[model samples]
Target: MRVIVDHPGWTPASEPRRTVRTENSAWTATAGATLILNRVGEGRDQAPAVDTYSPMDLGGSIPENLRSALEEQGPVQRLRTADLWEALATAIIRQVIRADQARLMYHRFCDAHGAPLPEAGPSAFPRPETVLALDEDDFAGLGMAFKRRPLIAAAGAFIESGTKWAELPADVLVEEVQAVPRIGPWTAGATLADVTGDFSLYPYGDMAVRKWAAHASPDIDWPTDEGTFARWWRSFAATPEQLSALTVLTLALGGPRGQDQPPS
Candidate 1:
């Protein structure tokens, strides 16, 4: 009955629960008959209900073939990150790296500079001001030399207009986030998807998505090229909402599972 979340910023907490720390709050979720969310702090109001979309959102409008493929994979839900900076930072760190490497680097970066929340195993991502204050040596010390400029650039941009940026719709948010140097379309799209739980904003051409889609439906002749694959994937959906469900369900087919051990 234990659940392990493989996403960055979340750490295994107790049995059957996962916990995360944001700048102003600590949150935990336990899976049972119903997924229960608890915020661990006084003075702060309860955690707000998070809106999520799933394959069911597409209803009967989903293509029969895609629906059959997804049904074999069971249910999947995309959970939005509680912190925008954390989502953006995770996307930035993930650029051009393997998912395992990105996960390690994210933990290292957070452990080094982020504020600690003992109750939550993982540290909260450092704030924009904190990231802006770090120098080349500081980043190099954590083996994040290549990420320094982009992280600093993003931090500066976030400081300037992040509040306004958070209010934007997913499509617009991707474009606005790309304004930061070294943050390309893929990174921006990933950030938008993570922060909004809107898979329509995901970079459909991403290798993970491409790989998982092919694996999830072997009978379909998926394109090998990224651009072509993205188009082919999109062609299966009749609407933006259906497209999102298709992408999310495919990812869930190969998504990470929790282990009995704690996060490394």
Candidate 2:
């Protein structure tokens, strides 16, 4: 059996296992077994919470075509990022780029500025302080000059009220994160969804979502504009939970790994 970890910054480690590190913990996951989490250095113990949701949860709410596609893709788990900074940073990096491009940039940014976890073979995202301390040359060198302002602004905002933001509900969190200068609706929505496991907070009109939805059900006429498509997407689900499930399942159907294999 093979298991793949879909979380950003995670990397494969030997057969059937993957590993990642955060500020407080180092984590290892083996196929068909519980996640093994250990303290990174030492400062209280922390572990990531894995939230699993099934496509079946949406039931009759989804269209026959979408439902069929999801069932074929199978169930997916939402592993919330242990660090809010990491989530925010990821969203900032992903803005206005293809998934493959964003992924390469993310890995590059981490390797350049983040602390290395040698044993695990992946680096942890740089802290807010580290981001603030960086000069323009540093960002430009990493090919992240475009993201410099947003990253710095987010770091400052996170330093001031990350704890409070973390406590806010998914909807509120999305709204709150937008206060930073360059952190717009789409970025905030993506960040909130990543940390909270509430895909209802995702920017439903995102190109990826729209693209995959159209790909999944070629017969359905999905809207082209962001606003109209967002409303059209909402009309399918009677409840927020259903909306989350529908959007997530649709994304999973044509995720980065491709259309056939769902994220585990």
Best by lDDT: 2
Taking all chains together, each candidate's TM-score versus the true structure is 0.84, 0.85
- Across 1-264, the per-residue lDDT of candidate 1 in tens digits comes to 112243554443333354444446777765443356777765374463344445565656434565776776555543457678877888888888766677678878878998776465556678889999999999999999999999999999988988898788777888888878898888887787776666788887777677766665567777888789888777777787777767777665564331111111
**Best candidate, TM-score-wise?**
2
Query: Per-residue alpha-carbon lDDT of model 2 for 1-264, expressed as tens digits?
Result: 112244445443342333444555766544343344444555554566665656666746566787788787766664567678888888888777666666678778878988776465556678899999999999999888998998999899999998898788777777888888888888888787777777888888877678888887789888888889899888888887878877777776664232221111
Give candidate 2's error at residue 209 in angstroms. Answer: 1.3
Report residue 133 deviation for candidate 2 (angstroms): 0.7
Candidate 1: regions farther than 4 A off? 1-6, 12-23, 30-36, 43-53, 59-66, 118-120, 257-264
The ten-residue window of minimal lDDT in model 2 covers 255-264
What TM-score quantifies how close candidate 2 is to the native fold?
0.85
lDDT of each: 0.68, 0.71
**lDDT, residue 15, model 1:** 33
Ten residues in a row with the worst lDDT in model 1? 255-264
